[model samples]
Structure formats: C-alpha cells, structure tokens
Target chain A: MGGKVTCTLGEVKNRADFIVYWGGNPAECHPRHFTKYTLMQKSPFLPRGRKDRTMVLVDIRETKSAKASNIFLQVRPGKDFELITLLRAMIKDQPISEAQVAETGLTIEQLQDFVSRMKAAKYGVFFFGMGLSMTRGKHMNSAALLTLAAEMNAFTKFVAMPMRGHGNVTGADVIMRWQTGYPFGISFNRGYPRYNPGEFSTVDVLVRGDTDCAFIIGADPGATMPQPAIDHLAKVPTIVLDPHVTHTSKLARVHITTAPAGISAPGTAYRMDEIPLPLRPALKSPYPSDEEVVRRIKEALLEKPDWMGERPQMLQNQI
Target chain B: MDLKVIDHATCTFCGCVCDDIQLHADDERIHQAKKACVLGKAWFLNHTAERKYPDALIDGKEATVDEAIAAAAEHLYQADMPLVYGMSNTTCEAQRECVEMADHLGGLLDSHTSL
Candidate 1:
C-alpha cells in the first residue's frame, strides 16, 4: 500500500489543480474528504481556491459527489475499464472503432476534452473508491486508472490513490507491513512467516473451516463477515475483545471487554492517507485497555508454557 | 465549573483526526464538540453516553479479568489449530503483542481491517 500510495491527503488538499473523484462518493462516504482535502478547499497553491481547481466526478450514477464536479462523467456501471482505456488511448492519439466508442456511451469528443483537461493541469490527483476495486474488472480497473495517471504525466504531474475508508484501516496496513513485511494475510504458524492474501485472509480461512479456534480482538466479525464465516465463529469456541457489545461477542466462549483506544486509552492511530497521529484519551474507562489484557494473556501463557502439550487434542478439537 | 473549551483537541472518532476540535468539557464530561462533523460529534459525545460495563466473562458467566484470561489462554493453548484475528481498532503496540502471542501459540493471525 505504501509503495502504491503516492500522495498524502495534505498534498491532495493543497497542490492538486485537476482533482478526480472516480467511482468514489466522497460527499457521502468520507464526508469531510472533499470539503477538507479536495474541492471547496482554499489551498495555498490554489490562490483563488475552489475557483482555481477543477474537479471531475466519474461514476456510474448521478451521485452527490458528482454535484461538486466541473465535469461529471457518468460512465456505465462496470464500464470503467472501457472508459479508462479509451481515455488512455485518446491521450496517446490512438484511433478507436466507432462501434467501440458507441459501447462506452461517451462521445469521442467528450473523452478528448477530459483528456485535454487532464493534460493541461499543473498537478492532478485521482481518487478512486470501492466502486473501482469491487467492480467486474477489479485490479484491471485499477490498472487502467493508474495507466491513465501515468499517461497524464507526459503532459502534467499526476498521482492516484484509493479513497480508503474506516479511518485507521490505513494504519493497520502500515503497521502490518512494517511488522510482517507484507501488507495483509501473514501467518507465522510454521515458526516462519508465510504471506498469502486469498488463502490466509480471515474470511477465506474461516469459510474453508481451517481455523479451529479463534481469538478476535477489537472487531465484530459475526455481523460483518460472510455467512459461512459467521457460522464458523459461532460454532467454534471463540474469544472477542472489544469495548462495545457486538454480534461476534454475543456468540463467543469468552468476551473480554476492553477500552476503546483513542477515546479511553492513549495510542497512535493512522489517518486515511497513512499519517500517524497521537490519539488523545478524552475520558476515563472502567474496562481494561487492550494493551493490559493482552499483556496479562501473555503472562498467563508464559506461566503455562507446557499447557498446549498437556492437551494436545485441543489441536484436533475442530471437526 | 463553567463549560471550558479545549482547543487542539483531536477527535479520534473519524480518521480525519481533526486536531482543531474545541472540546467543551464540563468536568470530565463533554458538553459539546465544536469544529466537528456530525460523525465526529457523535463519536466524541459517545463518551458521555450511558452504557453497561462488564469487566470480563467466561462461558457466559461473569468473571475477573484474570479468570477469563486464564480460561482463554488454556483454551487457546490447547487448540491444535487456532486463529488470532482482528487488531484494527487496537494500538500498534498491542497488535505487536498479539503477533508475538500468535507465533508462540503456533496459530494464524489476521485482522478485521483486511478486506
């Protein structure tokens, strides 16, 4: 994620002249993203601020995010690949068949205008969302977006990044990378690190019935995971560590309540753009902090080093 | 005491971590979260919201943190195959501890943050 993510939220907020909200409804999902970072911002580089910058909203529907755009490109759903490819081709002065142009629902002139605007900007930032990642072409759609950005580089400076959500989700990825040398789905089960995303990922592993028992910390998988995964979590003996009462905890063998990190415990959390910021504790919490509970668990485990050997059948406890 | 404004207060609610928040705190309770979005307001005010607190539980019975942890450790250690999942909302230090624990237990580790 670090290697791929090129620009910071600050950079996007201040420097970008041609901003694109592609397949992402920042108005709804991010709320403050457009207002604080992209459009409507009175940036230093943009002396006239919102007037100095131009935004393009490219989505399948007429989203609220589109209302803020100078030009809204409502490409057909799942036609992102086609639209992006056409933009890239048009940038390179390649001619396309009229039939192919008709399939995209965008006239060649509109695409050429979009490309020319992109080429003319001093600095551009392309912000994409789950619409691009979770769509039909998936990574290919992302590749096309990236390629378009790269092509724009010949005419002007440009960078693209996913409009990541869930706050510290970016933090989780950063910490995981520094710790395991992998972004996600890492296992040290064989006493060595193994990295595999689809195989070792939580839902995949749970759905495959590979995990026998689970210790869930700070998340509610039962409510959010796929049905099979939820069923597995419920059936198997599990532990949930959270401050809030969640669907997963309700079905757990042991529910250890912990204080919310930023609100009740002092810690460092990352912003959406991977900026590490100190999280100040605003209130006193009755529940133990995650750090304390985990330390206690480690202490308990150290005290019972041979416990696993004593009950070797625990490994085979799962069906 | 009168309502006081604490400027440069970071609202940990949303990822923005808007440090510009001026928390109006009366005592330790928040009176209002100024310079915040609705999401940030709800999150900051959530601290004062009434809620139940259960220290720990083991097998549907209330227990001390020690008792529950012991049970949990025992259950985890005995499992031939186990999973250590979800560290999204936790501190990096805590997440490191979890990774170490997972390695020691010879179990797998994953997160809710992983999509």
Candidate 2:
C-alpha cells in the first residue's frame, strides 16, 4: 500500500469483479470512490456497473458505507489480525478452527464462501485505512492484509491501498521522501537531516515552546492541532499563505491569502493510490499562487542578513 | 449571465482531489458545479463569495500583496526560532520553496508530517 498499487482504479472499475473495504468508509471519507469511478459507474466491461461488481465492507461496526455493500462483515475490533490470518490460511485451503471463526463473528461456511468468491473473481482490490493503521498490531494488521492480497494474486489480480486522510498527505510524504530521503518529521536544524516524530513534529515543537514564530505556507494547524499548539500559534508572530480564511488565518500576524491550488492555481497532486494527476484551474484567481508566494518568501529570506549575510545556515551553524 | 462548463477541473478542497468536476460559470463568476460532491460543490461555489479584500491582509487590515510579503519577511527576520509548517494542502513545488525558506532562516519547519 505504500507505493505499490499494481492496478489502477480504472482497471479496478473495469476488470475487478470483487472489491473489499476493510476498516475504512469510502462513502464517508472518499465520497467519489463509489459514485464517480468504481462501483456505481458503468463500463463496457461492467455492463451492470454497480451491479456488476461485488462489494464487501468489513468494519468494526455498521457504517453508512456498509449500506452499499453486498456483504458487511462486522468483525469484532482487535481481532482483525486473527481474522485476516485465518483468511490467508483459508486461501491456501488450510482448515481454520471454529474458535477463530467465532472470534471473527463469522461462520466457517461464510469464510469459505468469501474465499471461493475471491478465487473466482477476475480481480480484487482491498482498500484499508485508519481502522487497520490505528488498531492493535498496527503494521502487522496491514501486513496481514497485504499478504492476503499477494496470496490472492496467485488466483486473481489483486491490489491494496490505504484511503489517506489528507488530500496530499501521500503527496507530502512522497515529496518529503524525494527531498530528504525520509517520509516525515525530518529536521535540518543540525546542519544535516534528522528524522524523529515527537521531537521534530510541528505540534510537538510548538507545544514545547521551541518555535518563536511560525512560517505557515498552506496548512491550518490551529483548527486541527491540539489546543496548546493553537494557543502557541495564536500568540506567536505567524505568516500564513492559504486560499481560505482558516482558523489559523484569523490569528495570523501576517496572513497572505492566495488562490486555492487546484481551483485557482493548477498543480500536481497524487491520488490515494499514488497515481499522479494534473490539477487544472477552472477560474482565474485574484491572488498569487502558493508556489509563487513561497518563492517570494524564499526570495525574501534570501535578502535577510540571516541568509544573504552568510552561507546556508547549516554550514553557518556548524562554525 | 453567460454560463459555460469548465471541464476536467480538479477539486482542491480535499485529499481526494476529484478531477472530473465541471464548474458551470459565467463571464464574471462560477455558478454551479456538476460532478462535484457536496464538499466540492461548496468549495467551487465559494468562488462567488464577496470579500472586503481580494488580495491579502496584514494583521487583519487590508494590504497590498507586496506589503503582506514584506511584513511576513520582516517577521521572519526578527524571530530567532521560526517554525515553518502546513504544506499538506499545497503543491510539491510550493512545499520545496517553504523548505528553502525554513532552512535559510534557521527556523524550525513542521507540518502534518508530525501528526
């Protein structure tokens, strides 16, 4: 799920006979997942469109998204590992103990039927999210699902993806990986790149009163971050470059409003599946682009004594 | 009002970034959004909202774009330990620029990466 989505969503729409949603609700998080592309839309290959594909929703409890599923398995929370592990064994035709099926709240026959359907399907896509990432045995749960997908690949085309929470979080992480060779929470303060979460993460830095001022480019931590970070942001001198008038904007010491990236200023964004798509602006914006604003800030910083007066700070700091 | 369809416009409102949105608009402003969900529609329709200032604001008062940039730059110059953040919604190109600025100023840069 990190970077290997072997099949595109378009392929999933046309070729995938079966789709599984585990621990995430696309109906709630990704509204267009069912409507625009996958289940609801009709294709030459899928003449039945929504009807042509089988949808399975596996969640801890009943969710609105379950309303769209052909099968909704209400798995007991914290037992995802046991359930998926058993499913893996079922794929290999290995017998599963009834006790395990009871823990999963599903009968052995139901599990057998699911395995048979997956084996018969032309293709399958298993999408999971926070439910798997945030649960006990976190990465292990996801790995179990991935192992299932890989094992299923032997019988039918199968792929897995994480329904990311933020729009460009995957993009951000991708960009960070390209630039710093690390995904997130990287610090270059020591004249070299350092990767640590609580120490280098934004809110943690603010909560520790480590930041004297803030140079916020496109995000609003005030609306989302913990109260302590927001309070720190409100009191500190801050520069904001955003499209809307966000919670952080109201308290911004320097609020430089810009056009929204995709709506007003066109750019590139990676989808949840790590598919890069071009964002075409529909209207002309009155304000500058985020890139332009950041470039100007970079230019402005270049003129500062802290910058112009010395070498790149990393080197200057080392001396 | 003349209404026209802008096809294949990607929604900037969310992470989904649905690119199939068709913003129906006129010579002056946007009117209706076809293929956009409720959140995307709300985002596209906001193109018509009236604001006292169209370009920028400095400490809540309207300011020219140059003034805002200068004010922000001046603030960065004064702070001994500035923190650069919130690039989750911006483009990769813009994010790199923010990183450049953060590194140049010897500031503490942070974002959704922490959370």
Candidate 3:
C-alpha cells in the first residue's frame, strides 16, 4: 500500500523546481498558493522564484489556473485514474500503447514528454484538488496520484498533498486524529472510537436514514450534500451553528448563530500543509463562538443520564 | 472615523489559510482588507460586528439562546443515533467540543474530510 509522503509548504517554496496542479485551480481557489508559497516565492534554493520553476496543470477543462502553467494538459473528464495509472506504469518503464493514451484524451507523445519531465526534475510536487478526489473514482483517483508521486521518488525528490477545502478542515482532521485515533468517519456507539468511511461518513449515515438527529456546525450541508441526505436532515431534528443564515440553518430544527472562526472567534486553524496558525480576530460579534455553543451543548448532555453503561474509561484493547 | 489596523490576520475562506492579510476595521465592519485576494476581501467585508440576524431560532421563530440549547440537547439526546458533523468553517476549540459531544452521546462524528 502507498502511504502519504509530503512536506510542508515551506519545503515546496524552497525546493520544488517542478510543480503540478492536478484537477485543482489554485489560482482562483487558493489565490496565495502561487504568489506566497509555490511558484512566485524567491527562496535560497530557487533564487529566481517563478522564473526558475516550471508549472504543469492537468485538468478536464481549461481553468484560469492554466494560464499560470508552462504546460497545460487537458485530460478527459473522469479519466484521472487512467492517466495516473499510465503515468505510474510509464515511470516504471512499463509498456502502454497510443490507443490507451488517446482514451484519456492525451496523446502518447504528451504522456512520454510528461514522464521525461517528471524524471528529470530535481524536486517535484503534486497538488491535487477536489476535482480529482471528489470525482467518479474518488479515493481511487487520489490513491493512484499518490502512488505515482511515490513512484517518481525513484528518479527525483517528489511529494503530493491534497488542496483541502474551506476553513480549518485540516485542523479538524489533525485534531480528530489526536483525540479519536482516527481522522474522520468515527462512531462511539460501542463506548470507543471506531473508524469506517462509507458506513460512518455523515453523507452515508444521513442518506441511509441511520441517524435520527444531526448537530451541524460550520458547514452548510443542506446546500452541498446529495438530495437524499438533505432530505434526511430535514426529516430529522437537526441543529445548526453558523455565523450567517445558511442553507442548513433554514432546515434545521434549531439554529444558533455563532461568530465566524478566524474573523470574530479566536482559536487555531491549520493550513492545507498541516501548519497550525493562531487566529487573530479583528472584530467582535454579538453571537457566541461555535466553541462556546458546542461546549454548552456538551454540558447540557452531561446533565442528563450517562449513556455509557459499565464500559471502562480506557479501552484495554480495540476490537 | 478612525479604523483599527490588524496585521497578520488570517483568512480561513480556503485551505491555504493565508495569514499575512492586513485588515482595517472599525467597531461595526471591516473597511479594507489589504494583501488579501478577491475571495478574502469578500470574506472579510461580508461579516460584520453589527447584529444582523437573531441570536437563536427554533423552527424559524426567534428564541433565546438558552431555550435553543436546551431544545438542541433534547433532540440529540432523544435520538437513537445522532450525528455530529461539519467542522470545516469553525475553530479547533469548537471541533474538539464537537468530538466530545459525539463521544458523550455515543453518536457518529464526522467532518468535511469524510465527504
């Protein structure tokens, strides 16, 4: 199995001579990615900044980010997995025909050239976005890309990192890993943390009607989740905490307006590269912070009966 | 009117979480967001200190924060399987509270990463 091999944004700024944006349009989504960290930053290693670096963009369509790249490869929609697999095989000196390459909307010459560039670069990095991870193949596509990045290490220094979406998500992942020993998709019904993605994931649980109630904070899933999941949230008694009146708040049984994080709420938020930064709030809102509301909810729950029966505080062994 | 300048204010609109933004704000609203991108500018300019919406709402009707909290707890406690979800737009402190809430309720805990 291929595990994640990545470095901090500072490493990318200093050492990455070759950078690839796969399926992500960082120019618009993460505006400072190029100017502050990747292509435009002048470092000790990359003295010329954007002049010394090479950028490659691979996406189904031509986004604004393509303009910033030296080479833009327009891939066929839903063919990310196939393209990644071909790259992996090519990197290993395996055989692949032109017909197979054409199926992914890229010619054999383009892939061959891409492979040569991959092997020739001193330091390379891939920044994949939701366009790759949330596509038809989903995790399979992500895994393939990670595998390709790992394989490239044979010839040069290479790494891959996901361009995580919106506000302190990386913090949640990092914190959850520390507290529950799992990143996400966790259940504590058996008195300990249990991890399972498809089963315990919020969308799956809501779509299946397995959850009778939902406590939503920060995210507006009513506008983002699938119709069935949204319907289930409406069916159940849902509670929402957000600074503004969002789509989720409209359908929620209870909506508590809270101060927006990093704006009016003081706390920590992790960058996509897993760097923790302290939030310096500039304004004060009349509403409570999400932290206070969640803490109050927890205290309210504690006032009631104990849900865990005879289970010990610490689990001797995880089943 | 004098505006307060805050340097190194972080923008959490996206994953990059650019922390070098300089914000100029009064007590009511942010006047200018220097070194911020278009998205970051919109993010800072949109939210204000002035009261815009109700503090709490139960079934679309205005309610007290205490009443809303009690109602929320009652609903979650009464359910057989409750879900604590969506930590994407909040702080780490709130996220920790969410995890604790799930553990205490014996419920499902998830974040935007699972989606």
Best by TM-score: 3
Q: Give the winner by DockQ.
A: 3
DockQ of 3: 0.77
In model 2 chain B, where is the ten-residue run with the lowest total lDDT? B46-55
Model 2 residue runs over 4 Å out of place are: A1-6, A41-48, A77-82, A85-112, A134-144, A306-319, B1-4, B49-62, B77-81, B103-114
Model 1 residue A126 lDDT score: 91
Model 3 C-alpha lDDT per residue in residues A1-319, reported as the tens digit of each score: 0148889999999999999999999989998899988899998898989999999999999999999999999999999999999999999999998888999999888899999999999999999999999998999999899888888998999999999889899999988887888999999898889999999999999888999999999999999999999999999999999998899999999999999898899999999989999998999989999999999988999899876667644332221
The CA lDDT of each predicted structure is 0.77, 0.77, 0.91
**Candidate 2 chain A, run of 10 with poorest lDDT:** A310-319
True contacts kept of each: 0.54, 0.61, 0.89
What lDDT tens digits, residue by residue, belong to model 1 across residues B3-105? Answer: 6666766665555666677777764567687877888788778774233657787877888888889888888877877888888777776776777677667
Quote the B-chain TM-score, candidate 1: 0.78
Give the range of the ten consecutive residues with the poorest summed lDDT in model 1 chain A: A310-319
Which candidate wins on lDDT?
3
Docking verdict class for candidate 3: medium
User: Which is better, 2 or 3, measured by DockQ?
Assistant: 3
Every model's Cα RMSD, please? 4.7, 4.2, 2.3
* Top-down DockQ ranking: 3, 2, 1
Runs in model 3 lying further than 4 Å from the true structure = A1-3, A313-319
